[model samples]
Target: MARAAKKDAGNDTISLIPDDPNVPRPRLHKLIIKNFRAIGAQPVVIELDEIVVLVGPNNSGKSSILRAYDLVMKQGSNEGKLETEDFPNGIVDNAALPEIELQTIVFDKAPGDRWIGATEDGEMLIREKWTWSSPNVQPKRQGFDVQKGDWDDQVPWGAPAVANSRRPLPHRIEAFASPEIQASEISNLLMGILKDRIKTHKTGGEGQEKSDYDQLMESISNLQKNVVESTKAEIDVVEGQVSALLEKVFPKYRIKLDAKPEVDPEKTYTPFKASADLLMGPQDGYFSKVSQQGSGARRTLLWTALKFVSETKTPNDGGTRPHVLLLDEPEICLHPSAIREARTVLYDLPKTKTWQVMITTHSPVFIDLSRDNTTIVRVERAQDNAIHGVTLYRPNRSKLDDDDKRNLKALNVCDPYVNEFFFGGRVVIVEGDTEYTAFSLVRDLFPEKYRDLHVIRARGKGIIATIAKILNQFSSSYAILHDSDQPETDKGDKNPAWGMNSGILSAVNSASDSSAIRLVACIENFEAAMFEKAATSDKPYNALVRIRDDEALQTKVCGLLDALLDSNLPVPDGCIRWNALEQLEAGVAK
Candidate 1:
């Protein structure tokens, strides 16, 4: 998981808007799950955010929150205790009953009827209670505000309890579901302002002919008054100039208000399908092709549409301009070159009031290549299944001292990269960094083998200790890859170490497969081969290798590095092979 390369970690750009005493807070900023699946007999509560990301194993119930949202929207309330149809795939079979209740805690924000449209000055607060029985969850008015004060001190706009008692929050799932649907797909997720663009260049429609006729008549009446009072020559000359100016201003849309170009009667115009990507794309037709495509293509197309819409200005709605937005799993489908360009597109849009968006992925390319890091998320499923949850770690204010900054002067010396991935999520410890990199990378090297790969490297205390920590947390699986060896220092044991890694994976995911994806050797020295082969030549290691060399081979690796350094080769990859041991020998003589 790549981190946010933040310039200002602690500050939020949106200052808290003041509130009125009458207005109540809006809804849903926190979640409280009770006896919900693995979340023990004791309950677990997590706060929600504007950009909340749910992440965990396949069965850890990370998707439970979304399921809960869908249910409340569908059935309408959280009353009593829930039954089968209340959740995804029915009855929470994988999780226990009675112990399977998911209570959602809601926080309050703005106020008023914030549905279709709100007057610039209106504000409303909403709170929802969800149990197993009611489809009409109460939409009580906590309070209202005039245009100004902190949320901490606000009063209700009206007698909210009495008013809400009179009118129900319209059982319209459309209010909430629409935003979800819109956000889920790229083409559907137009800038909030795009909905108003059609109004700007509006064409008359059926059933509005009488109104149109009246408007046309009014315009003609105004024109007639001008024509009768003014000199015909002056009017004609002015009209001609206006037509020419319009043509110049909008060369692509040169439809004249006063004149038409002469044309041949028998001329044929070719049907358009080629030459421009825009013609076959979202601009002219339903972007149905994108949805029909696989996930990767769809993701890329989503990003493409966002980039296209953002570059072209959409009309303003009310006082705000509509922003077209698209988000693709930036690290996934597209080529690296495309990802870099797409990141630029994403960065440029959000600064405008017209757009706001976020993208996600697990690739390292983005971290190294990005110009900025305002948004990024790391997701991990815990090793044990007992209490499943996801951690959303951002580069916000942390109490890092000067020593911390000094320790991270180089990427090589920094703490393990996956430290944050396991931050709020479950921890699955492995042998070392090599195993971490190897487990994830090797699958790609041999795609025919692994299905879904998740790996983390625990720095010390061996795989057994890591597994032990995990076993105490969740029901996880493990996969240990080690070699056959005699008891060198009484620190080696095959079964215990193997169980450790496998146990952690199984425990956290709560998966049935509790065994390790273990690999053991009969009589070979695995570390020896690994060290000599995957030669990661840091300065000290390479320096030793140079001393071991007979001056000739030492000159070779040095020459290669120097030459590449001149051409801007990355340092992380300057040296990664076996000459270092040879250099160590020459150093011994010195």
Candidate 2:
């Protein structure tokens, strides 16, 4: 509102005006990692263009990635339980058992930074994956490619090929946000806004009961004081070092000055009004005095710094590009408008030739605001205690795209399609329409999997097609059996017109369809109940049929269906017999 003040530019540190308006940029190609906690040894190749979102349940460690840059700044300091290190200083119970191995790349050679640029353009969000199986972490696996045709109709100029780069004070930036994004430079920016809005005084009772202003104001004051007081000497040392560095670049500005300790909260309690010579925008009027700003404005003003920084930072002198931007729970404590506003900041920042911003958010509202190329990494834990025991998910963006192809597509795909037609969802693949319909109808037959998945019908317009569609969306193991009808080929003709090149069969064999989608066959009955002997588990389903009362057919079938198929939550007993999966779904009693 204050004419969208250029976020970090007007701040104290970066006052050095640029000689040229446009700075050169570098390419951000890939990221390499290992023993980096739950990730163990994994190389996460990030495309320079796409804006990624890291997600997962608690303990899945999605936020850790953002924290790593800080550790890197510290040169691998001893830290205990990650969450603890989240507080002040190194963690108390911290250990140095296994240090994390991490590296990143920014691809500059390719031209287009716009992921969906014209086909003539060949650059987009590409994910290169690697793994560290042992404690001896190192990068060794190939990453899966995440690309788009780079269509001309979508991105005309052909996206700019962003180069690899890092901030001038990468250490300071890391140090600022290290241990937690909540503590980074962005946090400093927020704190500045907060100090500007704090109600320092008010009419009150004679005692410490406080006049509403006392408690909150005191907390902010105390924390600010602590930071300044505790770090006085350290601040001096840093300031001295910074002064030395400045000499290397700008030797002038002969004005030697002292850095005001950040804890000098009292100084900022009063607002800095615009001088008569400098005019104020409409919103700027709100900040004429710290007392004038409403408390509600804190969320908006504090969060807007991120948006400002994005628009302010000029590209570097043709150097390597910054590969990733790790943002953790940015929506916390923000109002609906502020959250919405924050989301806009995230999406818009990467719309330019900037680095990929990978954020971890628990807000469904935020999730609803993303595009197709935004990767969603969902984390899960294991039975044993392992540092890098986290599962990563790169949601299939096709489902959302397909949904946008038409209207009926919405009814078939589900509610998620209503908002997201590209990224962030799950797919349930089965055999045919009957199976699709049956499963769709009985989908809730298994409540555990129903609420958690975005089931879509595909290919044969049946269960098998749906199965293929699901495979396209998710990366974990999934399979589907087709009612092959034992159709024998017209062997007599060398080139039989059997049309093996079409329909569900072709999709099953297409080069693009990786092993993520497995195809099996069942002849005779539509139900896959014959290939039991040679098939896999036919767990809980049999148990469902074995356990359900005569009235709850839906429950029984749904239970068996979920247990036989796959699910997010644990399958209930009536759902199916976990071990009997192969027999029921694949049509095999054995």
Candidate 3:
């Protein structure tokens, strides 16, 4: 067993031994929340991916999950004491207190370890409960006993003494959106870097700076002692008065005042106690505080500080605690160019081997579909009137080929609105720009009825299957509108359009049946069916002019839009559903 050793027999100070070399480090795997703010009594379990992205509407409980993790970890200072608002619906008389459970996994473990009821593959569960019944009782932390299938309160795994012994909790790093730059947030990041560097110097790090740093710390320590000695007379006078008052109650107790306040140099200073003010100036040399700058500059400063910490805190040989970053809407207050740059940095951060990232974003630029082991969770309030998080996209279910990945990356770069469907309720996937232009305009005609409708332009038929598969994974009720390029004669042939049609149907059928799917195809092409003409290169411009001037074409477009959005409406004429494709091919249905 590892033990701490005292320096002397009479000394009260003891030296701490390094963490156990044999025990495996724990990584946060999942979080289960119950009776917390915005979430009801039923537990909501969310699995943490290497790079998980949470995208949803406002006030949909996306931020609550991030706050819940910080509440349990207590790494960030933003979370204060729990109040009535912390409970579900702010009613706590007959309700259970809020509970947050952490599920962790440790790889390459030995036979038996300090984790009380860990599995053979090294899975462990720990929980924290808030106190609401009494004011004096603090929060409770416990572990699960797998053998008995119950929770055990005797376990002190996350307490201060046992946390850093053999089971070290991950260091939670957080950056949230604010109306303005918070000096304390930036100060904490900067001071953490400064302290880490000072620690490196004190511990036999290379260079003459180490000696200089030690000398500086010694001088400061001596100054702290001198100040206490000079105030000894004042302290004695106060102690005499305090002891006289105490003697009235005990009548036999004697009191002595010993004034000794010192600084350890490493343990004394922190960002919470002190602030680091950043000043910016132009070439003319008129410097001003960062707080006086614009919102853009302050946001940029926070981004830069976060990047600096991530760069400096590189992975060591299991000596440092693991880090999990919770970033809320990084694209806020950033210019378009800056948003792209921030997205690249955040997407690449998890590759550092010691960091895991989770972000809640409203911008599609922060989401990358090509990344591996990435999960996109869509948070929304369900019919049950409780918040729910559904996995909208994951790498395992996607099965994206190289070509599909290239197409997705190109779309992510070229089109800013390609991912808007992830935030919509009923989506319509169209093949070309003409359909997208016409359908979007028609949907706008009935703004209130089709307010939740999202029209996504695939730009090509090959990418339709990819979008369909993703929608299927989301379990969304959506429609796909495509062009039937050939007649029934070409169905048996090796036409690429036929192959693409089969692929789209196959993807849609994998997860949903006909009730949840709406497949519409325009015979020959969109222009041929709507205007009785051959396909033209300027179809998008023609669509605009025709929809604006021609009433007949506008009526036809509205019918198709209604068929796609409302399941009760039958498939409109000149448009073919999946089952009627054969009839249209034989010139019978149209």
CA lDDT, every model vs. true structure: 0.35, 0.40, 0.67
Q: Against the true structure, what is each candidate's TM-score?
A: 0.37, 0.43, 0.76
What would the per-residue lDDT of candidate 3 be over residues 1-590, giving only the tens digit for each residue?
22122232332222122244344345567788877778887777777777888888888888888777666555212343466777778777555777777765544321123333443343443333333342223456666654566676754333433342323233333444443335456655567657545544534445444444557666776777788889888888888888889899989676777655542443554324555666777988988877677777777877787777666754232344445677778877788878877877777666655457788888877888867868888887878878887778888778788888888887788776688877757889999898898887777766887788888899899889888877777755788888887634444656677557777777777765646788888877777767778555688888878887888888888888888877678766666777443554664334
Worst lDDT window (10 residues) for model 2? 156-165
Candidate 1 lDDT over 75-161, as tens digits, reads 323432355443333444445322222211111222232211222223222333333322223322112222343221232222322
Q: For residue 158, give model 3's deviation from the true position in Å.
A: 4.7
Residue range 524-578, candidate 2, lDDT tens digits: 2234332122223343344334334344645544554554345443433312222
lDDT of 1 at 560: 32
| Positional deviation of residue 569's Cα in model 3 after best superposition, in angstroms | 3.2
Give the poorly placed runs of model 1, Cα more than 4 Å off.
1-54, 66-89, 92-127, 132-184, 191-193, 198-297, 308-332, 336-350, 353-387, 390-392, 400-590
Rank the candidate models, highest TM-score first: 3, 2, 1
Candidate 3 segments whose C-alpha is farther than 4 A from its true place: 1-25, 75-80, 108-137, 156-158, 161-181, 190-279, 283-289, 309-316, 487-494, 512-515, 579-590
TM-score of predicted structure 3: 0.76
Minimal lDDT window, size 10, model 1: 166-175
Give the clashing pairs for model 3.
none
Angstrom error of the Cα, residue 236, model 2: value is 30
Could you tally the backbone clashes for each prediction? 70, 83, 0
